[model samples]
Target chain A: MPFLDEVEAAIPALRRYAHALLRDRSAADDLVQDCLERALSRRILWRRQGDVKPWLFRILLNLCRDEHRRRAARPVLVPIDSVSEAGGSGGQEEFMNLREVHRAMGQLPEDQRAALLLVSLEGMSLGEAAQVLGIPDGTLASRLARARAALRRTTCRAPDRPDDVRGHRP
Target chain B: MTERKPIDDDLLVRLHHGTAAERAELEALAARDPDIRARLTDWQRQDAAIRALYGPVAEEPVPHRQLRLFDRPARRWPRVSRIAATIGLIALGAAGGWFAARLAQPPARGADLVAEALQTHATYSVEVAHPVEVPATDEAHMIRWLSKRLGHRIAPPDLRGFGFQLIGGRVVPSATGAAAVMMYEDDIGRRVTLFVTRESGQAETEFRYSGNGAARGFWWIEDGLGCAVVGDLPVDTLRAISVSAYHDLIDA
Candidate 1:
């Protein structure tokens, strides 16, 4: 019962991280569901003193990675127009920018995307993020740097120069 | 551009863990360096955007359906206990009957067919030297030997459509007297066995799915022959392979 209580307490944070990673409400919920199932099934393996949040997060990260691999193996062709917009401030320009951002996130390598989401979106400390990812701190830093650069190139353009942004070679 | 001071990576790392004095020094350095200022501002903006995107999700209500962690353990225990007891009794009866029947008939009817298939499959699948009693290269001999012992003409199921090759066949004693098992393998080293024996008068023709330990068994009987395919594959994939075997072997 105490373990269940601890898991319940962590659900909101898990949902937040999953939402950021997946960028879709339904997918985020599904990821949270999967994480809970895994945690429950493997409860005996969990150490009582170890942080439950990070353990839950590790399970979530693995599930996301597996889902990504499966989707990559059998790539689906989803039309860009059919992508449901997330809850955000609306304008045609803003919509286009958000869509471009989402596409760019997809193009990022898994490690970089994961690192960025953990540090920036989940508000995890660099060390905690590294631990969750099972990667060294240096690798996490490099991934975060690459993710930041990619986001800048994808999302922001000089207001006066649309063509310049499109034409600028990386 | 005038002489621009280089920003230290150590300074940035420290800034993430710095006191007020360290923060001021970093800010002063950023003020003096245009590139550092630009990079720092870009990093901050990206951080803000990411936070904005995901911050509200942390406050959203978590759906109750997703909270499997809260499932009552007490509720699950009784159901598991009931199933385990039922399976244990069935297994004991089957095993005792099988051993007794093994003396006179050498094999019984339905259960021995499944056991033989599983045993033959396990035995030959591991061998690097002599996997099959008769190799696929000698298909004619393999077919004749198995069909004669089984009391019916049978051929190895063609699984080319499923990306598998016929390995060979073997005759093994089953519950119904004698049974024949044919083996097949895919490129990924997955093996499937087709177990067939003569259907006894008491044997019923009904499809059944059972998981004995980690291995899964799918069985059905038709036309006086008992057939069961056993493997460790996922249920859907196992079902697909079993259906394919049925189609090919029955037609053959």
Candidate 2:
């Protein structure tokens, strides 16, 4: 019962993370479904000591990677209308820019995106992110740096935002 | 006055990540240097934007219908039943086929040899001049030659009562190895052959009847030897010929 309750509690976050990774509502839902099913089936394999949230995210991310690999050979076209709809909100230009950032994120190499998402978006510590991605912490840090640089270049935003907490000192 | 050292690339990356201790160092560095503080601000904003784009995805609702984790009762039973029935039918069909084959050919060990002899006799006895390799006039040589080849002594049975004479014998292959068939002819040109070979290691004396083309045969094995009488004669005539041949061969 505790395991099931844990899984249920993780579902919303799983959906959110999957949606970020896949960028398609249906595909994200399907990924979440697969992750949940796998988690349920292999419930006994979960370690009781750690947070189930990261474990669930790890499963979902691995499934997403597998899905990406399977679809790697096939050419995928994101419809122009979906892109426009994603970019339409003028009040949230930054959010729209964020969506473009995600599109750029999608184009970033999978390992880099995975490293970035695990650390920055999912709020995982570098050590935990490294463990989840099955890489060394140093390697994780390098990947995160590369991913951040790539995102900055791809989005082409100014180096500083006035509203940011750490204002430009120079 | 002297100066201190610079940060390495690994340390710069760590500074970009900015742990609690690293943040304090960055604040102190910002008080001392403006350029490093500006880079830190850019890094922080970039981190924030990346977080904003992906952070809310985890809160989205998971569509239950897409999962297919739960099965519908209407669809489940039929598939299982169909698979079970298919397996059952395959097993039943195999058992039935095996039973039918067993009934058609009983477990008699000498049946195959007897059948093979009857088939061979019926096939070759219809030949005119080539029915026997050596003519009956050379009876001793024919017997000795056929006996040497067949690994058993073979004497042509006298079918005088059946109005047939031994024309001669020839060596041929048999199911039990080499065999000899001694040809005989009646007055009307009807020919019958007494097919002989060593018993195929069976103890029972069993008779079988077989027909091919217009020829009928009565074959039996006894005392480590097998014999078949084949001709175009009626059933009674074939039986009579076979009995007379059997008596003469056994007596000899």
Candidate 3:
């Protein structure tokens, strides 16, 4: 496939990964913008020369790291109205069930949350996720395990689940 | 050599698959150790919750801004020309000033190097990815690659305790030779760059600050090595970061 087309195809996946990383939809897209522009500008630097998805994601992750660092330097003041604003993505009533899990995921530490988001949410293989994250496989696994434990404590609500055919909520 | 675990790889692989065979083996194992059931259940539930929370993002449309990155010509010569113009202007100033004040040599040269460092920072820091030619994921390779290229043993400071993570280092062409810039990001996405080059003429200068508009810089020289720590952070924070890095990288 041509490079741009391959990059285009990966857009949805990249959006998912960025959304998982940044939490806010618009901010996630901004990070994706930073990633794509960086990738486009540094095309010559891409030693691999093909399949820009992983490279695209690596940049996105690094940018997110910078953004996260910047966020840490300031006083955090989360708007209460932000939750209502997010309701437009999906109807609030329809997404009420998802909110619980989202809240739980937010409760996780940044590293562990990103680790979980990559493997499970993005459905990336452990190896690919680790490469995008620029971490070792062992470190990824430990992060996943820790994230899993954290999520299970805060999010597992079998009693609250709807009568879905599969035991899991989509 | 590292010690090997008793569990076979096949069984573990099966456990990941969650197949009937894997479940049976796991059940047997869980019978021996009850924690296995809890761990498995937790892993499964975590997977489901992540999917529930973030699955929709994949189905959403790609924002126009992200798609715009590819709209430009592949190799942007405009930026290159801009940098060249800036360099050209600097050269013109240096040539014009050489006859004016040869006695005030150190400050002018020092200012120029800081400008170079600041320009490099401004260019590369916006990069979401590929900020460093060598990603911090491969710290050893980054250090080794940078060290070899710079013709000096370079140990990137460990700044995790100060809430800064070393993203990696890269080699760039400098006036002297190839200079090394190690990039770091703190917890909130703010970045601080450490600019390093060999001390020319063995000019060992004292630690000093250079005001850079909204950004700030602190530079020092000791034992034929010079470093300038630059960032847009507030002065005190920048000083703290600079001092911490100096202790870990220079004094140590």
TM-score of each: 0.49, 0.47, 0.51
Residues A4-82, candidate 1: write the lDDT tens digits. 5567788988887777667667777888997887676544335446568887888788777767755776987533221
Worst 10 residues of 2 chain B by lDDT: B1-10
Model 3 residue A23 distance off true place after TM-score fit, in angstroms: 1.6
Clashes of 2: 4
Least accurate 10 contiguous residues by lDDT in model 1 chain B? B1-10
Model 2, A1-170: lDDT tens per residue?
34455667777667656655566767767788877776654443354455787778777776676566556779687432254322232434543365666577777887877777666666777767776776777777667666655666667743454322122211
Error of 2 at A105 (Å): 2.3
Query: Which lDDT tens digits does candidate 1 get at residues B88-114?
Result: 424534334334334324234445556
> What's the true lDDT of residue B208 in model 2?
45
Estimate candidate 2's alpha-carbon lDDT, on a 0 to 1 scale: 0.63
Candidate 2 at A133: error in angstroms? 1.0
| The candidate that achieves the highest TM-score relative to the unseen native structure | 3
TM-score order of candidates, best first? 3, 1, 2
Docking class of 3: acceptable
Q: How much is the lDDT of residue A26 in candidate 3?
A: 69
Interface RMSD of each: 10.2, 17.3, 9.8
User: Candidate 3 chain A, which ten residues in sequence have the lowest lDDT sum?
Assistant: A161-170
TM-score of chain A of 2: 0.76
lDDT of 3 by residue, A66-165 (tens): 5665577695764322433333344333323456666777788878787777777776676787777887766675566556555655654322322211
Which of the two candidates, 2 or 3, achieves a greater TM-score against the reference? 3
